[model samples]
Target chain A: MEKKSTEQLEAICSQVRRDILRMVHACQSGHPGASLGCTEFFVALYFDQMTNNPDFNLDGPGEDLFFLSNGHISPVWYSVLARSGYFETSELKTFRKLNSRLQGHPATEEGLPGIRIASGSLGQGLSVGIGAAFAKKINKDDKTVYVLMGDGEQQEGQIWEAALSAPHHKLDNLIATIDLNGQQIDGPTKDIINLGDLKAKWEAFGWEVIVTEHGNDMSGVVKGLEKAKSLLGKGKPVLNLLHTDMGYGVDFMVGTHKWHGVAPNDEQLENALGQLKETLGDY
Target chain B: MENKLDTKYTYTEKKDTRSGFGDGLLEAGRRNENVVALCADLIGSLKMGAFQKEFPERFFQMGISEANMIGAAAGLTIGGKIPFTGTFANFSTGRVYDQIRQSVAYSEKNVKICASHAGLTLGEDGATHQILEDIGMMKMLPNMTVINPCDYNQTKAATIAIAEHEGPVYLRFGRPKWPIFTPENQEFEIGKAWKMIEGTDVTIFATGHLVWEAVEAEAILRAEGISVELINIHTIKPLDTEAILKSVAKTGCAVSAEEHQFNGGLNDSIAQTLIRNQPAPLEFIGVDDSFGESGKPEELLEKYGLNAKNIVEAAKRAISRK
Candidate 1:
């Protein structure tokens, strides 16, 4: 895979954001807000930060791995994975369709190239990442494991359970980032359940914490991820508190939880796509 | 179909099935370096101490969080590691059903969910600890193979055997120091039922702790001139329907026994097999839609109608109905 400049990565982010809106609008029932907001982070990881194989091996023997905890944002991941060459970009049109490799949630049952485990029921991905990291350590694979989780998903007790176990195992090879978009399906996360001081909470759990305010910015996310990589083999797992907006880029949908699950209507789809440039062309 | 009682079943000692799991897990770790063990703070109870001591790097102490253990086990499979998760039946199935369903079974990950202290025989820990409905919960999952080995020897074979077999498996065993009747070196088959005795009067399909009870009932019935054929239906999910149908065809009557709920356990499996293939008179011997309380395992078995006496009565009732 050829290395891309920050400008090229930003271009891919725009195309991914466009793909998210188009895929959601095509299905008429998929998540676009969080997918839109997490575009830059996904772009940065796949395009610039991580050394992964798009050839797609289940075991991922010598390559870095990523697990999506917040499966609702499959649009952004599918787009990024397809754009990054895991599968054909044209296959992205089959999102949530019958007999499609891209299921409503990321699943391995269909034998999807990039997916190693099924994760729709929240708070399990962190543990999975830790397990993968453990496998890497046992096999003497020096590659890292990354997990992306939703902020509202923090309400799940299993997340805390995983949060405690990762550091206890001293999985310094694992890096977890939370999409602190401050919005959930119900409303704002503050209204439903307050996750007070996640940084302090992670620190209290004995993790090396790194907070990045510009989660939607390609350069900032890339820097934060690189810093996280530098902290590995330092005897502690790292947590990146990525502060992203729920519905970013699009003017009307920005900063609202309304688009959390609801797909963009015909007019809204046009309006949303207009904001994100067609840098890599429509799938 | 003849009753192939290959050897006279006998045991001079009583051992807990959990030990078989412990020893088998240790052996499995030795056989396959990919075989790793994870325990959610039940290292002693699940008898994972030996494996932990031997393969320190392979054993993961996942604290008291069963859900995390299950999820982690699923993920371990992606890196070519076969993880065997250990915990109580209650936590292994019911507490982490979602985790097992999505992460392990649904995803088709090769995870051995080795659960100890299953059913009413979990004893004084009471109803909260004993999980009678675990079989039903796991059996309903798409890719889960539910196994309830009757004794120590069988449980040990199962623990080692599941590592060789791919996909997710739910290996159910008990805590009590029960009679060890099965052969020590028996090759544990995942979905094949074992024939303990051959008879014509009735067929007794038993699993987990109740296989020994069926054996004792065979003796009592044999004295009364009633020939009884006992079959151990170890693997409940991919049920050995052919063996069940063949045996029931010869016997004409059947008694289903288990240390689980009468509704979902071996009773349901046998009843379904019989009703679907060869419908026959079947009597159920299990906890009759009730929860177990604080008591010794023997006392609890007798009180809950899971003993030889109950089996005798049920067998007689099943035979009389024919």
Candidate 2:
């Protein structure tokens, strides 16, 4: 697949951010801060980097796998899944309501097409990813495995356990991304629990580490991802620390913990939607 | 480190069921390439050392990470591999339940959750370590196959049988050694109960270590002119309802014994079976809804009413109800 230009990738991410705000607003209750924050990175993955068969059946024998360890941001994942043709874009309105396949957290219990495993209780997806990657290696398949974790979720001891296990197995085909968005539901991550020196910590576990600040810039993310993909199949695991502002596009929600879990009321919705273009039209 | 199972189930010295689990795991490594073992520490106790030594590549020491080990085992199963994960019963079921629920049972992964030191047999480990609820906890999984083999031969056979089957299985065993009476190379069948002895007076349904106690109790009862039928229920989930119903029909009374709690454990399954199909006068012999303290295995058994004496008393009580 040919790479998209920086401007085009940014345009797509802009559209995704717009979808996140509108989808959460329509539901009247959902997590939009992390969704809004991780748009560009996911957009780059879906449009530029991830080797996913969009028409995903749960068990893709030779296909690559991407696990959203921080599963509360289901809005962004669902939008990306729909936009990438895992299902119809029309199904986006069933975000959190009854009978909707799109649940509050990513779930396979509802039989959503793209999901392989259910994840909401945090700090365990890396182990799942490593297992998948290990299986692929055993089968001699060349597909890569990717997992994303929230910065706040780094407090979970299981995350480090999975992290240590990943590199110990020389899981060079697995790459984990940490969404270093400085806020969680309770408040800023620093106040709840400070996960100091994440790079040093990951490196200490024998992972080849990379840091990126271009969470909103598609070209930079795509480039970093390319380097990440190139480094795979080596003897060391890769850990990419992605720094991004929470609520990146919506000015009102940006940089504040209030927008993390609080649903935007009618007036607030209008203010938030004013900044984002209706690229693919609101659900 | 201990090679007690090298003989054909005829060892003089007694050993814990944890050692049996380790023995079976070590043998599984030599027999099949697809047989990979994962453990969250406790390698020596689980008796997985030989498997680790023989096929060092296939064994994964998952540290003290029970959740990750379960998830990884689930992932391993996706690639047509038989993964035997060893850990204490408490951590294997409750600590990482969500992980096992999502990654394994829900996904229908063919992983063997081999739990060691199950029930009150973990003795001095106290109530915290004595997971008498593992049988109930594991059977609750929709796709999980729960097995509690009686002794050395049955546990080893069940461990081998799980590899041939293609789904999730929870193999629960204990930390005490009473007797090894099951036949050698009998080809353990999943979900089928074995009738150790046949009689007309009463049926004593037992699993894990109690199978031996039930046998001993049957011998004593026979001397007293009481003809007792003995049934070893190795598989708890997909409970052997056919065998249970047939035996209860002939005897008209039944006794259910296990090293677990009576309410949600093996007794409940037997009660539910009888209530549905073959209702009989029933009395359960087990840890009656209470926590167990750390003690010698024999003392704990006597104190908790999970021994041969309790089985005999329950048999008499059940027959009187009839």
Candidate 3:
């Protein structure tokens, strides 16, 4: 398949944002804040950065694998996975519904094509990524492993344990991206639990840290991911600190912790959809 | 009744169940290329040195991070690698429960959670290190296979057997150097109880180090003309319900024993089975709603009412009640 142009990728990101808003709006109980926040990162990874096939395999051999650590943001992943031919685009309608493969959080028991592990519990995906990266090394596959976590999830002690492990094992084939949106449920992350100088923290933990100022911008995400990929195999894991608004793109929801998990009302949905534009058609 | 009990079961030497795990893990690593091992900084304690030495590439040393070890083990299964995580029973279950629940069991990943130093026999470590509720905690999880092998030989066979079976398994063993009575190369079937002795008076359902105590209790009861049947319940979940019912049907009374607490251990499971199928007089020979203190393994077992004398007393009580 030919590489998708920047404009085409931007169109996909816009559609994913629209899907996130609609899925959460339909359920009336889902996390749209981080889902909307990480729209460009997901689009950029799936559409451009990662080497993957639409023909999904559980054991992702000879391909770059991605794990959603902060799984509350499942809408964006569901949308990107569906839109990228992992499954039918219409399946996005079943988000969080009973008996639907699209669970509230990404799960493998439902046999969803894209998900390999059930991840709603924060601070587990990094260790999982390390294991997959270790598997790649064992198989000599030479492909990379990518994982995304939320900024609030850094408060979990297990994340710090994994933070030490990845570098100790010299997991150079792994790239971890944190959505530094500075917001979590109940309040702002700094108010709930301050993660002081994240870049310095990751650096202290021995990861090659890279920060992207414009996480919502498609071009910025693509470039930042490219830079992360370039720093691979340098005997250290890469941590990309992506600066993003908690509830980006939507006028009312943006820059607040209230919408972290609360779904928008009907009127709010219409308002958010009006801003996002149905570029690739709504699911 | 067709009795499969080994009447002449005996051992000249004793060995810790953890060594059996280490040896069996080495054999498993040799048999399957996909077999991989991970430890949370208890290399010497978990007895993974041989497997690590042989398959250096397959072994991962996850330093003092039980949760990360569990999560990584789940992740390794994504790439079709059978990961066996080793640590103390307390850390394996109580410490990293959410990790195992979400990543491994919930997803039905084929990961082996090999836990050593289980129960009050993790002697001298006190209640904090000794996990008397691990069996209950693990057996409660959906899609989880719980196995608590009795002796060194049985633990070895179980360690190798679980590697062949699919899905998540919690293989619980102890730290004490118990008598090695089970056959060296016996077929260790998951969820199947082994009859160590046969009688019609009372059935003693025992697990882990307590199985040997049950055997001793059988001899003591038999000498007093009170026939006792001993059944070794290795696997706690997907329990051998048929065997239990059949044994209890003949014996008319039952006694359950383990190195764990009575609340959620072998007795609780047996009580459930008996109540559901054939309610009978049952007595428990285990810690009674109490934590264990630091002592020699033998002294602790005796003090906590997990000894052969306690099993014999419970057997008498159960028979009298019947």
Top lDDT hit: 3
Candidate 3 lDDT (Cα, 0 to 1): 0.91
User: Whose DockQ is higher: candidate 1's or candidate 3's?
Assistant: 1
| Candidate number that wins on DockQ, 2 or 3 | 3
Across residues B177-203, which tens digit of lDDT does each residue of candidate 1 receive?
987888888898899999989899999
Off by over 4 Å in 2: A57-59, A281-283, B1-32, B124-128, B276-279
Rank by TM-score, highest first: 3, 1, 2
**Candidate 3 residue-wise lDDT, B1-322, digit = tens:** 0113333466777999999999999999999999999999999999999999999999999999999999889888878899999999999999999999999899899999999999888899899998988888888899999999999999999999999999999999989988888998899999889888888999999999989888877877887889888899999988999999999999999999988888888789999999999899999988888989899998998888888788889999999999
lDDT of 3 by residue, A163-274 (tens): 9999999999999999999998878888988898999999999999999999999899999999999999999999999999978888888899889999989999988888
State the lDDT of candidate 1 residue by residue for A87-168, as single tens digits. Answer: 9999999999989999999998778888889988898999889889999999999999999999999999999999999989
- lDDT score, candidate 3, position A279: 92
For every model in order, the fraction of real contacts preserved is 0.80, 0.53, 0.72
Residue-by-residue lDDT tens digits, candidate 2, A1-283: 5767777777777677777877888888888888888898888888878787877756566777888888888889999888877988889888889999888888776689888777777876788787777777777878888888999899988888888898888999888999998888788899999988999999999999998877766767777888888889789889889988888898888887787876788888788778877766655
The TM-scores, chain A only, for the candidates as listed are 0.99, 0.96, 0.98
Model 1 clashes, total count: 0
Regions of model 3 farther than 4 Å from truth: B1-8
- Kindly give the stretch of ten consecutive residues in candidate 2 chain B with the minimal lDDT sum: B1-10
DockQ of each: 0.86, 0.48, 0.83
Clashes of each: 0, 2, 0
